[model samples]
Target chain A: MTYTGHLQLEASERYGKSVLSDAYYNGVFKISRPTYTDENLPLVQLIHVGGGYVDGDTYLTEIHVKNMAKLAVTTQASTKVYKTPHKQVMQRALYKLEANTELHMKQDPLIAYKDARFTQETEVHMDQSASFFFTDSVTPGWSKEGTLFPFTCITSKLKVYQNGRLVIFDHLRLKPDEDLMQLLQLEGNTHVGSLFFIHSEVTVEWIQKLRDYLASFCDDQYGVSLLQIPGVCLRILAKRTSLIEKIFAAVEEFIHSTIYNRSAISWRK
Target chain B: MAMTNALFPILQLSDSQFPSGAFSHSFGLETYISNGTINSSASFRKVLEIFLANQFVYTDGLACRLAYEGLEIGNLEQLWQLDQSLYALGMARETREGNRRIGDRFVKIVSTLYPNQVFDQYNMELKNKNVFGHSALVFAIVSKHLGIERETAISSYGFATASSLVQNAVRGVPLGQTEGQKILVDIQPLLTDIVNRIMLLDETEFGIGAPGLEIAQMQHEAIDVRLFMS
Candidate 1:
């Protein structure tokens, strides 16, 4: 439709439980009913009805978690970016979490097909006490000519601010037209992924333990870094997207079992 | 006369022996060294080339470009925003703090040594805790105040950065000084080319960092008994 898509979700705490207070979607965005899991954490899934992200298409998503509320959002499947000849497909996600709130976004891999151009910017603003977790992955989509790196461009930028101070900013600009591998120093690897977990309790000891734990499952291609603001980011470059996903799964498990003293609910394919 | 006026200060600031405290940080190289990812001079050079093209051109190089532009427009707010953005883009905690430390020291020493208004104003912000200082931004301001050309300032900064890292690699990788000098000499052409590209780069092209290098820098923090501060 050469138009912009929109989605807004609001969640709050009531009676010691989190609830989806308000929701809105238009232009090919659909949300499944909120499902509450252990600890009153509501899981919401976003469905893209537009088939695939087309050229010149833009999507805007705004999510708010009110005081002490908890929310988790996921995608049903991988987001496919089709050819964007005329212009690049753009997506902007804005998230706000009030004091002591928690928000998690587990996005599926972005598969960019041949000649595809995609740019996504995600910004999160949270209180000092709030907790946020985010996951993103990128994979080269189908190529008729059987090329390895077919996507024209894939750019993902994320900025997280706590209490109105910029803390974490990560920008990944991948262009197959350029020397993509050498440009990013990926060491001949293709798939790329990142997980950012921001919480006050994230300490050096905890991150080191997580790093040591992941060292068995993950190859030397992956790295875990602590943000100065009490958070950790794990980034990996791999030839297979599955490896990245597996590492992230391990990280989630570690975080839940060690820090939260709970089991992470399995995310089935 | 003007060229010499600018050149001497640029050289003084760019010298590794200067009191900028940049030598204390490796940013991410130490992690790779510990992991044996950068054991040889060739491996170090490959990583360095990638870093120069992929990360430094956008982050530090762009900061200098933007800082110079901000100075031209006489906008202190622009410089402030640049400093904040540079600080924010550093995902590694140790690397981020290390940059802040070097930049803080550079500004403090230069402002006191040169006695310029813009430098003092910028230093005041840092002293007053208004903004986290970044070396690239400070380098640009110091260069501008010293009447150094923008391209020269950027090239000098790039050269200085490469040489300092080369020194670190030589020490950490246990390579000889000859190898360090060779690596430094080899990157001069790259320094020229990167400076040119950064000059024409738009602000939108700024803050680009590779996941691999960033991870290395991040992991450097956890290495027990690390050699570098970053």
Candidate 2:
């Protein structure tokens, strides 16, 4: 038997300020009090009410933003998945960004403990004019004997559609069977971070500058990919979670200040 | 279609003179070569193994297997979706375009050389822009039409891929011809191993590979001077 928790949130701009006009969550899920740090953008924190994820735990999340609206979403804490000898923790998120809308999703790292398995998929449909920013990380959790990759496997997938045409699709699976430390794989890194940003304002020049900026961090291995559509994805493989997050945070700040032409918003961790 | 005459076409198709346009792309080799991670033939062979094991086995190899089965069952929709998934899963734009170009070129060349209904249908889909054809899928269909054995088709396909990279390394990494052949010979068993692994993979296990290669391929796009497209 499996129970599926669901969260639906919608936001729109009213009187020049974004507000959470509609929100619903049931079955072991809740949202923290709306935090307004940008004075107009509402930060919605997803709170898993029934504690950490376990075997057979599944969740569905839907986020929508009306035309001209701006919204930010993050998790209250790290997603911890314990031993799942039988079933894997499955999570799905759907996003709909109307024309001229903006959505930023910066969530905490997912920790896959010993003998755990986790899979997450995100699908997004947005108009050509909409702007979307999302970042995620995967980190190994605790183990009795202190193994680096004790989890069974961790899988993530993202598919993006602009104007009903699939433009970006990224699929990643990390398992112990393959040597993740190889030059063609993780390059001796344990933590993985990814950033996906889609905006009409993206350009070749911007991507070049961003790559130059990231190249300064010689200790961490990073790659920035320009989407066929108007966006970019940056993936960083680092030895520490802080290293990964630092790269992501720097890129995020660059996007905000350089691309969005505003000061970066503090996640307020 | 296996009228004891299939060997000639398979050998010709796998030959380096086929003009498959694989020479124009090094996948992610440009990045590694420029960054000094793949200067020697030895290092190139090591990365090639990783490529065979991590990326190639899961993506193109699996797609070829699936396309073969799909054709046997007369399932065209699955092939269409397979093409789309291949395109979508290609996070790096250059690698995506490179493979797509090679796939489309295969469709064009094979249609004239050995006409088949599956090729016609795939050509139609390509014309409609409904699917982004892949070389692996196209070759599988062609192999089926030619009555080539599954293992032969897979092995020859893998060989062509490996051969092209080695050939590219001859110019990019500047390795000797004998050195290139050594790398090719070295990877033969690994290719067989990859095929064995691909046979056991489930549909859900597709697209499982290292992000490091993808990142390297992505970085190739930003390099100031690039010999290959990918």
Candidate 3:
């Protein structure tokens, strides 16, 4: 069966507290109640009610935040692209943030099973005052045929913009059935992770600390750089999925503690 | 005669003394030198070969090809998009800035030498901050203006990049002048292969996946003392 999902979130400041003024979702997508951390940031989890995607599944997510709203969005669990012998699975996401607003999207890595074809595209539109934090990851899933990286293909494109001017564009395409290591330089690694934090508030001190932190504990191939615009972007390739997750979590915690002066809440599944 | 005529312009643009400001930038090779990852001429040659095969062609070469197509069609929007893509793909701040500076200067020179409406439009967009001027894109525009063949244009840019990297290595690595020349000679076949292969690549094949090289560049930013810009 084909599935198409839509989500729209409009957040605004009211009574000295930022709240979700409008939330909408259709089809197979659902969201939980907002949880606040010490920083008073509202956090929500996007749940795929259908559990996983099959052949020919299409999902779309649209998010927006107005002035003074601080929000974090994450997935309930990893997105699973099951074996598809016929058609491909596609997902599209769009985010818009206005002045004095911030949105952090911590997406769980996509797990592609054998014969699966998954495609994803995400675009961020932001005002100069708005900051965006986003993460995207992909890992090979278990295959019944006992082959590593058995998935047919996975393609993902991410773009960032400030006031309609594109700041960054990244595209990743992996065809495991082919010689993936030689072409894209996966280097015999199975997991790929990327983090992007775009904000005018990113300072030199922050960059230094972040650089030091990444250098301190990395054992796999990883890169952390200040984007041409404001903010930082980190890209990692690892052999294990858990390692990527730990690295991202550590970086997020460091950012929260240093910038927000608050401890990041340790969320439980 | 036609081939030799095309060769002259290619040689002029790709010359090491072209004042493109590329010599001041190591394109991430400085970090490798400082970290001892590329100490010897042999290691340097290996890294350059891998860089050309894995990263440079996919990113810069593809951008140049796309830019040529955009100019050929006279599509300002396409040119703008190509510039944006190339700029954004460069996550390192110095790398992106270097590209912007070199590209802008290249266009300025081309405009003065041979004024054209497309170059003017690109300049206007750059002035308006609508697009980040990338070196590869500007080179494509200049090549088109000079009537350079598409294959020759792309190959010349590749040769220039490889040459600049070698020049930087000679200074940064403190390699002997003869050693640097030998390294360049060693990579000629690889450069030819890469140039040929890059021409066959589709737009989607352009990507970023060389973490070791990228990480070296990222770490270059935080190093207390640095010789090259990136």
Candidate 4:
């Protein structure tokens, strides 16, 4: 089945209290009502009614955060791409953030089962003052025969634009057909995780701290580097899925405690 | 076949002694050596092949091709966009900085020698710090400016990149100079093969994934002592 999800979020201030003025979603996507903590932060969970994607599926999601609003969007569960023999699955998302707004997308990992071909493209358009923290992981599902990473292909591309100029364009396409164990490819890793933080307020100290935090995990191979823009990009590769999950958890906590000066709550079911 | 007038320019730019500061950075080879990961000839060759097939062939080759096309159409805006895209594709900070440094140096030297209006405009952009000047793009721009054919320009670039890494391996991995030459000879066929492949590559295939090599370059920054910049 073909699925397309669209969401638009706007903020309104009444009596000096920030509220979700407009929260809308269409098609196979659903979002929980905003649960505001003491700081008026809205935590929204994106839900897929059909659980996962199949052949010839197309999904598009648009998110807009108005000025001075803070929002975080995550999935209800991992996105699974089942085997596709006839056609590929495609997903695209666009995020627009106005000035002084922040959007954090701590999405669950995308799992591609054997022979599954999946393509995802996400682009962010924001002002210079806006901030974004985005993360995504990719792990292949095992086959009945116990083989791993048997998926046909996975293409994921991310681009960030500020003031109409492209600042970051990250594209990763893995076709595990040849030389997969080489030093330049996955290096025998079964799971990969990537995190991008683009905020004008980020500092060198935060980057270093994040690097140290990533280094503390000995089971995985990770790296933290400053992006060309005012932000950092972290990449982690490990054999076990839990290792990358742990890294993501730590990263979410670090951003919460260090950058936001708040504590992160567990949203896991 | 008639000899091309651009042949000399291609040869000159392809020379290692052209002084683009290409030798100063090892492009993460130092880290592999420091970690004792690439100490033998076979290992060095394997890693070099990985570098070519996985990282350099896609990233640098595609950027170079795009820059050449952008310049051919005299589209400075397109060139700027391509530069930004190439910069964004770099996952390691040092890789980004190092490429910019080298590109800046190449433009500085070649622009002075050639002194063309196109080169001047690009130099102005670089001077104004509007966009990051990457090595591959600069190489392409200069090659195009010098009237070099696209195929010759790209193949020369592939060879130069391979030679630079091989030479660094000779020094870092401490491989015998003969062993280094042999390794280069072994990979000689791949130069044409990769350049041919890159020539036909689509823009969608521009930045093929190389997560392991990227992490290694990033880890290069944290090593206590570093011989090369990247």
Candidate 5:
């Protein structure tokens, strides 16, 4: 069966923040505070809900960050794409960050089981003075001793506009069966994540700070470099899925406290 | 009879000694070497092979053919479209900049020596707008101006670039001279097949995927210090 889910967040002066549901079976996922947060700060909460299957072909997830509001969105558990006897599963995420707002978006690794076929497309747009930090980690699913996922292709495009001018445009497409792990490819990396942080007013000093913070979580081989433009991009490759996820979480919290001025989110036990 | 002599211009245009600043740029090889991903001569050969088969085939090879045909028909719009497509396909800033630099150098040299109106016009357009003048486009313009056959010019240029890369690998990877020559000899047959494949390409089949190369190129941008401009 096909599944489709959409979640929209709108800020209300009276309600603090409201999660609006358009369709799909919704579930709330909790994110715990990182061990590093200061004792005085409150832990943030993330509400995750997914609607049931529609036709098994297409699924949609929409996240909206309202003006001047901050939100941290993450998955409660690693999402598994089961092998279908017949067709592939397709999903898309549309994230909108309004002016003066921030979204610390991260997700658990996606494991594609053997014979499973999946495609994901993500589009993000951030307004002027807005900040966005997002990470997507993916891993090959469990298969028989030698077999792996039949095919997995994920394409993502992130566009940042400030005052109607295009500031940053990032597009990525990944296909695992094409031998992405080959030396000339990802250099035999099984787990990889692309972390991007964009803010027009970000200074060189700030970039260095971010780089140092990212460097502190040293488990895998990762590289952090400043874009000639205003943002910073980090690409990390690791063997263990859990280590990568932890590093991602730490980076997310660092960005939240320093850039967004938001409290850390406490993960659900 | 005419075809045999026609091949000379193709060879000359694609020659590594053409002085279009091709040797100065290792095309991210310097970065890879510094990072230790490419330590030996053998590893360099592997990297170049993957680069040629995966990236140059789809990108520069296809661009060369399209630009050659575009110039032959005097289709500026088609050429512009091809240029835009190349820009979009290039994900790394340094790689994109390297292409423009090489293209500009080619146009500057050719405009003074060859003095072709088409070359001058294209160069002017490139300067006025931020149009990316990639090496493939410039090679096409010069090859066509020199009255060379399209397939031969494209293939020869592609092969020459691959050879230069191998030579750079020899130096950077510290490979023996004989080993470098061996690598070149090994790649000749592959170049022939690539040329044939490039010839059969259609515009609709443009922009084939090569993500690893894109990532490597992107990674090159963040590399702290590098010998090659790219």
Candidate 6:
């Protein structure tokens, strides 16, 4: 079965926020907030109910951030994808931000059990004044023997559109049997995460600052660089998923404290 | 006689000593090593295999073929379009710059000896900042000018690059000279397969699933101390 949900947020006031959907399925819940209180940055929570079915297969979530607004979206719990006898689970998230708006979205790490296949695609559109920060974390699943799957594949793509034109495109395909952890590949990193931030007026100095900030996490193998366009991309290849998640959390918090905080100070009062 | 002569142009263009500065760039190998992903020769060998199988087969090989065929029919627009598409497909700044740098160097070398309208025009465009002079595209243009067949040119380019990579691995991994040649020989069959695959490729298949290499190349750019120009 296929399920689809769409959420849109338009900020009315400085701290006014709206909840688009907070629905729960067998064990999986679809929680989204289009707007949030900048004053407190309330944490929206979604819990997985025991005995509930947790099938990420054929699931879709879409989010739209309107013009001149700010929104931060995240999940309350680490998502677990249970293995099934017949099919692999699939999940996709889409984000759209209008001109002069900002959207910061990060998902808690996902753990996929043995024999699980997952495919994800993220599409982002940013106007001249628009800004975006997003990340996705994934972990391998275990088999019936309590061992990880001998073979697993994950495919993901991130497409960015600026001024109605395609600007940056990123894609990753991983297969365990193919020796993906080799140096020429993911370099033996079990956990891989990508962070993309796009802003037209962003300068090289700003990118260097962000890079230095991300580099402060000393435990993981990470690299940050500027894309061909006016944007910055950070890729982390680490031995542990938790490390990557912590780094992502830290980055999101930094963005919040710096960018959002400055805006709040200027326009809030 | 025609076939033998056809192979000659390929030989010259594919020579590692062509002085295009390809040897100076590890194309992210240095970064991989510093990151500890490539600790020994065995690991480096594995990485090279994956790189040849995934990246070179799909991207540079295809670009060489298209540019060669485009030049054969005097399709400048097609060549320009291919260059633009390559630039767009190259996500990393260093990788894109590497392509342009090698392209410009190749054109400079060819313009001194061959001196044709096509070369002049492309060189002029590159000078005016109208288009990025990508290495594969320039190879196509020069190989066509030298009267080499499209298949020979593309295959030779592929083989030569694979050989160069093995050579670089030899130095980076510090493999013995004999061991390096052995690695090249072992990969010969795979190179042939890749070349054949390149010929059969469609344009839509370009730039498919190369994030590892892209990320590595991007990282190579910021590597504080590096031996490669990439």
Compute DockQ for each candidate against the true complex: 0.67, 0.68, 0.47, 0.80, 0.24, 0.36
Q: Write the per-residue lDDT of candidate 6 for residues B1-230, one digit (tens) a residue.
A: 13345556567767887877778777777777767777676676677777888778777778889888777777887887666666656666676677767777877886775567888888888888667777687667767877776767767777777777767767776678787778777777787788888888877566665556767887787788776777
- When sorted by DockQ, best at the front, the candidate numbers are 4, 2, 1, 3, 6, 5
Best by DockQ: 4
Per-residue lDDT of model 4, residues B49-155, tens digit only: 88887677788987788889988888878787777787778878888889888888888887786667767887888888777777677678767777777777778
All candidates' chain B TM-scores are: 0.96, 0.97, 0.92, 0.92, 0.87, 0.89
Q: How much is the lDDT of residue A2 in candidate 5? A: 33
TM-scores of the models, in the given order? Answer: 0.95, 0.94, 0.89, 0.94, 0.74, 0.76
Give the alpha carbon lDDT tens digit for every residue of B28-141 in model 5: 677678778788777887788878776777678888898899888889777776765676454455666677678778778766765677777777778886466777777787
Candidate 4 segments whose C-alpha is farther than 4 A from its true place: A1-3, A11-17, A217-219, B1-5
lDDT of 2 by residue, B1-230 (tens): 43578888888777766887989999988999999999898899998888888778888888889888888899989899889888877767788889889888988997878888888899999999998778888679878898987878888888888888899999999899999999888888899999998889999888775789988988888788989999
**Poorest stretch of ten by lDDT in candidate 5 chain B:** B1-10
The best-first sequence of candidates by lDDT reads 2, 1, 4, 3, 6, 5
Clashing pairs in 6: A26-A52, A57-A89, A57-A90, A112-A141, A113-A141, A181-A188
CA displacement after TM-score superposition, residue B119 of candidate 3 (Å): 3.4
Give per-residue CA lDDT, model 1, range A43-101, as digits (tens): 99999987899889999999999999999999988999999989999999999999999
Q: What's the TM for chain B in candidate 2? A: 0.97
List iRMS (one decimal) for every candidate. Answer: 1.9, 1.4, 3.0, 1.0, 4.1, 2.3
lDDT of 6: 0.66
Candidate 4 residue pairs in backbone clash: B28-B230
> How much RMSD separates candidate 5 from the native structure?
5.7
User: At residue A134, what lDDT does model 1 achieve?
Assistant: 94
lDDT of 3 by residue, A130-232 (tens): 8888899999998777877888889898888888888788877777754556322565677889898887868666787886786687666677778877788
DockQ of 1: 0.67
